[model samples]
Target: MATPGFPPNTLDDEGCPLWISGLADDDPNHSVHVVRGLEPAAALEALGADPRLIQPCELPERKPDGWRASLPAAALGIEPELGDMTLLAGRVGEWTFVYDDAGATFGDVHVLSAAGRIAATSHFSINADASLTYYADGDELAWINVDDLDLETDPAEMPPELRAAFEAAGSVELDYLEPGEPDFDICMRVVSALAGMPWTLDDLRRIPLLVAPSHC
Candidate 1:
C-alpha cells in the first residue's frame, strides 16, 4: 500500500479518542485500542506502566522488543529513524502498547514539531518481532510489510472505460473501483499497497468497510 495515511478519527461513544481494532470479534488478546489526547508518557502511565522504569533509555530498545515502531505507531505512519526517537510504552495484561505524540504523516494526518509548526512526519510503528503492523486504512486486523513486494494485475478483466481509468492511475488505485463491481477485488490490492503494505483475498472479507465509497 502507498503507506497508510492516518487512521479515521475513530472515537468511543463517549467521544474520547481511540482506535479499536483486532484480528477477530474485537478479540482483546489480538487487538489494539489507540487513545489520543494524552502525551506519550502519561498514556503509558495510565496503562499500568511506569514510563521512567520501562526503558533501556530508548523506546526501540525496550526490554526484548524494538517497539519504537510498534504495530499501533506504524499503523499511523510512524517510523523510527535512529535509536533516539522519544516514545513511551508498557505491557498491560495481554497487550503491550507504545505511545508518542510525535505523531505521523500520511495523507492528512499530522502533528506539530518542536518549533510549533506542522511536522513533516509523525510517529508510527512496525511490529518487527511479529513482522506485522496494523493498517490505518479503515478498521480491521490488516498487517503490512516494511519492504516492497512485486505485484501484477491483469487489466483485461476490466471494461474498456474502467480499464482506461485503471491504466491512467498506473493500475494502482484499484480500490477506487466500486464495490461489488468487476475488478473491485483487484483494485482493493492497490488501495492496500498504497498503505505501504498489501492485503490478501482472505483479508478483504474480514476488514471493516472501506472508508472510500465505490464510484462506478
Candidate 2:
C-alpha cells in the first residue's frame, strides 16, 4: 500500500496535526466543519450562533476543558443532556474551523452554507458511525458515511474535490489500524485538503477563537 501524505501517529513536523493524531487515539465523538472564505466571527453567525453571545478566547492548552470552564454557565447552555454545549471557531487561512463537542449544527445545511462553502466531518462514538459532508450556498453538495463510503445524497451532485478526497481516502490501506481509527485520519485529510493546508498544533493552540453556546 502507498503511504498516505498524513499518517497516524506522525508528528506535526512530518505534516500531521497533533489534534488529528490525538483524535485517532481517542476516537472521541465530535463534529468539525471548515468553511471557506469567512472569518471566525462571521462563521459563527452563519452557523446560527448569536453574534452578541460570542467572545474571543484562545484554544484550551490541552483540551476543551480549560476554556470551557471560563465561560459563564449561561453561555454554556441549559440542557444537561447536551453537556457543556459550546462552539469554538478559529481561522486557518481562509477556512474557518468550527469545533462542536456536543452539538449537531453541522447537519443543518442552511446554517452551514450561510457563511460559505463548508467541508465537515462528524463522528458519533456511541454508534461508531462517521460522516463527511459538504455544503455550499445553502444547499448540500454531498453527504457520505465514511464507514462504508456510502453516498447519503445523490452522487450526481457531489463536488469534485469531495469526491476525489473520498476516493483517495477509500483506496488507502488502513488494515493496520483498529476500526474507527482510520476514520479520524481520513476525516482530517479530507478537511485539510479542503482547507489548503494542515492546521498545525501551534495554529490550533494560539489562534483566538470566537466561543459561543451552541443553540442546537
Candidate 3:
C-alpha cells in the first residue's frame, strides 16, 4: 500500500530504495533516503502518518580523511552549566556531541550522534561533592566536571571489591584520592571500573556510579 504522495519502490538490502528523488550515489547533497518494504502502499501510508519520518536530510558525504567535521555547538544548543562545558567530534559520516554540565563537582555527560542517535553516556559523583560525565563514540571520547569537583581522597577507604575492580581496570590511582579532586579523572576511573561489565547503550540509563558521598 504505497501512501498517496510517496510511490512504492524496490529497496536494497541496506534499505535503500531503487529510485529516490534528489538522491545520487556521489551526490553530497543527499545521504539519506526513504525506502518502502515489499508493500509500497503501506509504506506510503506510514509516511503520511508521520511527516517526521522523512529520510535523513542533513547527513554529510564521506570524507577522504575518514573523520567528518565536528558538529557545531550551536546545532545542539547545549548551554554549559555554571562550571560545565560541551565538546563535539565526528567524521564525515558520523558526529558526536557531548555536554558536561556538572563542572568539577558532578559528572553529567550526554552524547548524541549525527544520525540523531545517542550512543553512550555516563556520570560519576563522589562524596566530596565532585562529579564527572563521559560520552564515547566509535573512536572518540569526551568528558566534563562540576566546579570544585576534584579534591584529594584516600584509596584505602574504597570497598575491597571496588578497589579490586579499579586495579583490574587500571584505575587504582583514583582509589587513594581524597575528596574534591578532578571530576574528569574520577569519571574516567569510574568508566574503568565498569569495564567488561556487559554494558550496552540501553543500559546507560540504568547504571549510576558514585565515587564518594558528595554525589549521593
Candidate 4:
C-alpha cells in the first residue's frame, strides 16, 4: 500500500529498492507490504493499521539504504495467518495492495505480483517468518552473489556434502550477485548456505530457511 507522505528512496547497490512489499498470506483478500524509513507508530496511522498484528524487529543497522521492515496487523481487509505473510519495508505509504496470485520472489525476497495464477505453492519461497521449508532455487540464487566463491574455492570446508552437490552439475559456476547484497545481506548469507545440500525433495520442501538463531 502507498501512503501519501514518504520521502524519496535510493535503490541499493544491486539496482533494487531498499525495501519491498510482498503478498504473503495465502488468502487472496489480504496482503502485507513493506515500507522503509519511518518508525512503526507513524506507519500504523498512515495505513490505519492495527497495533496488535505487527511483529517489529530491530533492523541490523542504520542503513542509508533502508533497513526497517514495517509489517502490520492487516491489509486490504486481510490479516496474517499460518500461510505466507512476509513483507520487507522500512515505513508506510499509500499504494494499497491487490493481487492475482502468480506472485513469486524478486531480488531474493518473496513478492506477490499484481497478476498471475495462484498455484499450490508460490513460484518460489524460502524458509520464512511463517515456516522453515527452504527452496533450492532461491538458495542457489543467494550463492551466485557470494563475492568470494569461485570454481577453485572448495565447498567441503563449510558443509562439504551440500557444497559438493551444488557443484555437481557439469557446468556449475558461482557467477551472480552476493546474497542479500544492498539489503538483507545477513539473511542472504544464511539463506545462501542452504543450497547444494543432501536435501531430498521433501526436505527442501519441508525445512524452513535457517539464519543465525539470534536473528530469528
lDDT of all the models against the reference?
0.27, 0.55, 0.25, 0.25
Range of the 10 consecutive residues with the lowest summed lDDT in candidate 2: 66-75
TM-score of each: 0.21, 0.68, 0.22, 0.19
Query: Which residue ranges in model 2 land beyond 4 Å of their true spot?
Result: 1-4, 7-17, 20-27, 63-83, 115-121, 150-158, 167-185
Q: Evaluate model 2: give its lDDT.
A: 0.55
Model 1 spans with C-alpha error above 4 angstroms: 2-33, 51-56, 59-216
lDDT of 2 by residue, 1-114 (tens): 232444544333222345543322232355667777778887777777788989876443343442333222223433224454566777877777776655356575456566
Q: What is the clash count of model 3?
A: 41
Best by lDDT: 2
Highest-TM-score candidate: 2
lDDT by residue (100-161, candidate 4, tens digit) is 12122222212211122110111223332111112232232122322333434534443443
- Root-mean-square deviation of every model: 18.2, 5.8, 20.2, 17.6
- Rank order by TM-score, top first? 2, 3, 1, 4
For candidate 1, write residues 92-211 as lDDT tens digits: 322223333222112121121122211111122332111122222232223323122112443464334333423332322344443222221222222222222232213322332211
TM-score of 3: 0.22
* Total backbone clashes of candidate 4, pairs 3 or more residues apart or in separate chains: 25
| Candidate 4 weakest lDDT stretch, 10 residues | 207-216
Candidate 4, position 50, lDDT? 36
